[model samples]
Target chain A: MSSQDYWKANLKLLSVLLFVWFIISFGFGIIFSEFLDQFSLGGFKLGFWFAQQGSIYGFVILIFVYVIAMHFLEKKIGIKEEENE
Target chain B: MSSQLLTYIFVGLSFATYIAIAIWSRASSTNEFYVAGKGVNPIANGMATAADWMSAASFISMAGLISFLGKDGAVYLMGWTGGYVLLALLLAPYLRKFGQYTVPDFIGTRYYSKTARLVAVLCLIFISFTYVAGQMRGVGIVFSRFLEVEIQVGVIIGMIVVFFYAVLGGMKGITYTQVAQYCVMIFAYLVPAIFISILITGNPIPQLGFGDTLVNSSTYLLDKLDQLSIDLGFSAYTENTKSNIDIFCITAALMFGTAGLPHVIVRFFTVPRVSDARKSAGYALVFIAFLYTTAPAVAAFSRVNFIESIQEKSYLDSPDWFKNWENIGLIAWQDKNDDGLINYSAGKPFEGSRPIFSDEFGSQGQREIKNLPTLDNSNEVYIDRDIMVLANPEIAKLPAWLWL
Candidate 1:
């Protein structure tokens, strides 16, 4: 990939991951929390669960996914750190 | 051993460990002082970063805040942790690639403006000083409660201990000491939670224990909590009390603020590679999630346990824990209508008439009872929410070993 293509791919990846983040934290966790609470998970309402623990778990998973995805992307684009050195 | 003696021994030993680490890891040059010689393992840096990020407020007030806020407390849980996502995705790798010693350094060179650098420095100083003041106050609170000294004396002792290690070892010393602190703080936070979880829900793992059925009851834990809250005239535990707009604003602001915090961002600079910086953020969240997840469990269990143990009891018949907290001015009770019963509820005091409690009267016990709008004049209990977590074990009657 050219340098411009590499940068574009990176930005696209960020946007996708960030979109998931926004939905989990602000969307389900807050705006639709009451609606989600109509369902139950164990003793927790689905919405309440999303707000308290689900969003946090989602964040942790999201970051690691970004890390792994970026590692693969770097190799495919021939922009790995070793190549630069 | 007596609890006070145990406290002295544990606190003294932790202080010694910190000072010893300072001596062993003393920084001889600016590189070591600023960035731990840039040789720290990602895992070790992650633990240190976790320790640095989990400040006094996280340690002392977070669970207490959550316990009172109920479902509304999700703002903090999501806000604080969600910011790490922003940091990892948007800032950490790029800042690591930039390879600067400080945030201002990165901003100055990137923006190409000396004026921008100076402004960044000023903003950094202001934010750091305000944050340090809260941390110092947290130190004093822990000392005064555990060591039995006045808050001022506790603060002085804390300053002296910090000066020895922080001034001597700089970032190098702090990094190692923080790893140790992470162990102690997490242990201190988790042990009681495990014990309480087992006591209330018959499960040792607090996360699962929170959802488990209450001991000796068929009802699930959250169901019991919702009922208890309503019985006490408080909102249901699972109900959302905050407006969607307010919650969104607060959570978003905290997420952005956590990502932008200077101290937290600086932790990325200590790692060896940009890749390691990414992994370090992941590992740090893992460590932080251990406490963040458990804290809600602690809050839920404590709120349920407190109501079961204390509600509807007469002041004269209250437990020793209640009296102990009262001595510290954290719990108060007045008979109001001369009925001698404590009525805890969620509405405005005396229907918003604001009857001054005896403590607020200040040497004149002549406040008119008739002027207060209380139903039967029995609205006289004031309990500071900070006491909720610290007093949890005592209220639950957990073993003394977990008290520390």
Candidate 2:
């Protein structure tokens, strides 16, 4: 893929990941939290769980997911970052 | 050894180690100082980033804040971690490509304006002063609480130690020091959390422990806590008191602030490859999560322990730990009922927020305060939110050296 095309693909991946990030943190964590509190995860109210721990766990997972996706994308584009500077 | 002497010995040893590391890793030149010669390994850099990002506030104060704020504390939790997502996904790669590797450098050159560069420098200085002030306060809290020194002495001592490492060794030295700090921070934060979790819920893992039923009880810990909060006239432990709009705004502000914090942004420059920059953020968050996930459990456990420790107890029967904190002036009891049973409820016991201690002993042998009781509600305890975390080990009666 051309550099511009590669950039576009990267942006697409980022947008998708960030969308999940927002939903998990802002959406479930705050906006729809009261509604979601009707449900329970383990002994925790679902919204409370999200507010406390779920969003943090989600963030770590999303970042790693991006790393893995980018690794595959880089391989596909034959862009081998030099291991040594 | 007394807890006091033990704390001093432990603190002294740790300070020696940090100074030793700082001297050992002193930067040789501008390249070494600016970006650690741009030679840090991704994993090491990540550890450093976690330490740099976590700060003194995260180490000492965050769980305390979370304990009191209840559901509304999500702002700090999500805002901070979310900002990392933004930093890693949105800003890291582009900044890596910027080549200059500093925020001020990026702004100046990007705008092609010396004025912008100067402005960036001014902004950094302002932000840094506030950041350092918070750091010194964290140091002061630890010292005053643990080692029995004045808070001012603690801050002055902290300034000297930080100057030795950060100012002398610069980023290169700071990174190595922070890597060590991250380990110490996570270990110190988690050990008590695990102990408290097991003590309260018969669970070793604090993340799940908070959700587990209280030991030998049918009710869940949260249910019990919610009941305790309501019985005491405090809001339910899981309920939100801050307006949703306020939570949203604060969370966003923290998110943006975390992303834009100069110190954290600068850590991305330490890595060699752009991919390493991304990976480092991931690793940093992973390290950070060890504390973030456990903070709520600590908060819950400490809150439960604190209320159980003090509420509805008489001044004559109050625990030494209670009196110890009260002597420090973080814990104040004004017996409004004249019966002297220490009544702790939602509102302040006196006017103007904090009590003005009169240095005259009350009839109950409590340190007398000049502030008149507001008499709005019968809550006679004035407990600083900071006490929940700082006083946890003492409240929970954990060993002196478990954290040391």
Candidate 3:
């Protein structure tokens, strides 16, 4: 991929992941919590679960996902760190 | 051995370990001091980052805050952790690419202004001192409670111990010492949690245990907690109390603040490669999530345990932990209406009537609520939320090892 294409792809990936990040932490966890609370996950209210633990789990997974994605992207774009270093 | 003696031994051992690491890894040059010669393993750096990020507040006060705040506390839970996403995605790799020693150095060079660098330095100093003040206070509180020393003496001991390690090792020493600290702190945090999880919900993992049914009851733990909260006139544990806007603002502020913290950002720069920096952030979040996820469970468990153990009990009949905390001024009780039973309710006990105790009494002072000639004496008990986490193992009657 061209350098510009690589940058664009990276931005797109970031936006998609960040959007997920917003929905999990702020959307489901906060704004729609009462609505989500109507459902139960295991013994926790779904909303409460999202707010307390679900969001945090989501964040951890999100970062690792981003890391893996970037690694793949770097290879695909021929921007490998070893080459640059 | 007595818990106090055990505390002394454990604390002494940990201090020795930190000092030993400092001596062993003492920086030979400024580069080693600043960035560990930029040779740290990503995972090790991640653990050190976790230790640096999860300060005394996360270890001691977070669950306590969540216990009292309930749903309102999710702001902290999400805010603190979610920032890692921003850091990992937006800042870490790029900053690693830039490869600067300090945040101010990056700001100075990137902005291409000496003025910007000076401003960054000033801000860094201000923020760091404020954080250090909190950590010092936390150290003192822990020492005073566990070591049974005066707060000032505790502060002095903490300063001396810190001075030895910090002066001896610098960043290289701190990196490895912090890795050890991460292990010790995480173990300290999780052991009690695992024990309490099993005791309360029969689930070994606190994260899952929080959602499991209470061991003796058919009802879900959260369901039972919600009922208990209502019984005590507090909001349901699952109920959201703060305005959505307030929660949003607070969460946003905390998330951004976590990302913007100079010390944390600097941790990313210490890794060998930009790719490693990305991986390190992931690992840091993973380590952090262990405590972050478990803290809410601890909060819920402690809140329910605290209410069940103390509420409506006669002041004279209060548990030893309650009295212990009271002696430390973290808990206080007054028999409002001259009834020996303590009335622990949600909100300020004296909202409508003039408080028998002056507001000037502050946090630590004991206010005599007796013989208030002017107002109806309805206010009864005052408990600082901080005591909840420290005294939790005791309140739940966990084994002595978990208490330490």
Off by over 4 Å in 3: A82-85, B349-379
CAPRI-style class, candidate 2 = medium
lDDT of 3 at B108: 94
DockQ of each two-chain model: 0.60, 0.76, 0.70
B1-404: candidate 3 lDDT, tens digit per residue: 68778877988899999989999999999888888888888899989999998977788788999999899999999999999999999999998898789988998999999999999999999988988887887777787787677668878887887877888897889999999999999998899999999999999999999999999889998889988888777788888888999999999999998998888888887788899999999999999999999999999999889888988787667788877766665566655566667777765554434333443332223344332332443446667666677899999999787778
Worst 10 residues of 2 chain A by lDDT: A76-85
Per-prediction TM-score: 0.92, 0.97, 0.93
Error of 1 at B380 (Å): 2.9
- Worst window of 10 by summed lDDT in candidate 3 chain B: B355-364
What does candidate 2's lDDT look like per residue over B7-88, in tens digits? 7787688778877887899899987898888888889988998888787788778888988878887788898888989999
Q: RMSD, model 3, all Cα superposed?
A: 3.5
Deviation (Å) of B358 in candidate 1: 7.6
lDDT, residue B326, candidate 1: 60
Runs in model 1 deviating more than 4 A are: A78-85, B348-379
